[model samples]
Target: MNPASHGLKITEQDGVSRIDFVERNILDEANIQQIGESIGAVVDASPRPRLLICFENVEHLSSAALGALITVNTKVKARDGQLRLSNIRPQILEVFRITRLDRLFVIHGTAEEAMDTFG
Candidate 1:
């Protein structure tokens, strides 16, 4: 299933699945829920189940969004799948660091680097 939000772009290639955040901030609860549902659908549908979420365009993230990510991460892990994050802005990256989520996810400087690690 495709993401309901146009702000998210989902793509799959060579057994690697990527979800790119096209928007700058994920602040609203509705958007957060939509994104979470979209990610959940992707996790459920992916065959190889290697998911990369690119935060290249995201400058801000809300608590709800962070919670959604954690939920998706758990779902991915439950399926024995790999979930990664890439291109996180420094300020936004600090949230992960503060929340200790940085230790939970495999983060990379670029989407290509994250995809490479899936190999």
Candidate 2:
């Protein structure tokens, strides 16, 4: 699915990449790869100290998304940077909690709050 059609807006703020994903069935491998590759491209293009994902419109995340996050986290860490997450939906947060990713990732209620914490 095209992100713009659903009003998905992915942008970067102060080195933090905010991915406002519209509600879509991100359960498939293609979608997962697409999302990961996009973010990976951004990471490759930057020299920033950190990579933060502010998930605004995403209500649910497939395990694929979680895997992508881990990949990004590992990649960022390899470069001596951090990968953070914010603006998670409560339901999605539950998934993270169940899987212990909530502890793995630096989650926040809002992107502003996340930036404040990181800064």
Candidate 3:
């Protein structure tokens, strides 16, 4: 048997957590859990408002990923924080629309846009 795990790199900046996926997204449970934990860690570390930026590494996203994000977004909102996304591909945009998460979360056109919004 063979196994593959998606790549991800997370950094902190300006009171926000920047998550960059180093590999293509498969939306696997491992990745989803990590994503959730990352958000939880940030919130637990400080329940203050935060902006989470995803680099949109994959053209297609998995349902698990989206669900995890929705959960994280709800958590952020509960803590008076915001979850923002960037670098979304056109096809993924369609998925967001299909799921209506596009309306729920802030999807930025680029990392600069996300940063500029706060500034």
Candidate 4:
């Protein structure tokens, strides 16, 4: 499925579905919602979703964005699918750690590594 906003880019290959968050900073409340919705749309459209969310270009994530990620993670779980994260900046990673969300989500050094988990 095509993303409603340009903040994300979706790609599927080798039975692995990936969504790359294209924005430099996911600090805007609206953009955060858009990213969550786009993720939901892509997961809804997939037959059997195995999602990798790449935060390679995202330097910062706001509290709302963090909430959105949690929401999407729930959606993925409800679909009996998997969700992984990759390329998170150190500062953002610290946020995840502080929130203890790092334990809630499987994170990787790269999108490729996250995608491989689906295999």
lDDT of 4 by residue, 30-118 (tens): 77777888888877886667888888888878889989989988888888888899999899999999999999999999877776788
Q: Who is ahead in TM-score, 1 or 4? A: 1
C-alpha RMSD by candidate, in order: 1.8, 3.0, 4.1, 1.8
For model 2, state the Cα shift of residue 81 in Å. Answer: 1.5
What tens digits encode model 1's per-residue C-alpha lDDT throughout 1-119? Answer: 35364568988876877888877889989888888988888898865488989999998889899999999999998888999899998898899999998998899998888888885
Off by over 4 Å in 1: 1-6
The better-scoring model by TM-score among 1 and 2 is 1
Predicted structure with the largest TM-score when compared to the true one? 1
Model 3 per-residue lDDT tens digits across residues 2-91: 122225566778767676666566467886787667656666566676665565777656899888778877777788776788988888
Q: Which candidate achieves the best lDDT against the true structure?
A: 1
Q: TM-score for every candidate vs. truth?
A: 0.92, 0.82, 0.83, 0.91
Distance from true location, Cα of 62 in model 2, Å: 1.4
The RMSD (Cα, Å) of candidate 4 is 1.8
| lDDT scores in order | 0.86, 0.72, 0.72, 0.83
Q: What TM-score does model 3 achieve against the real structure? A: 0.83
lDDT of 2 by residue, 1-119 (tens): 45422333566677676666654445667767777776776666667546667777676678987997888777766766667788887888899999998887888888788777654
Compute the lDDT of residue 109 as modeled in candidate 2. 88
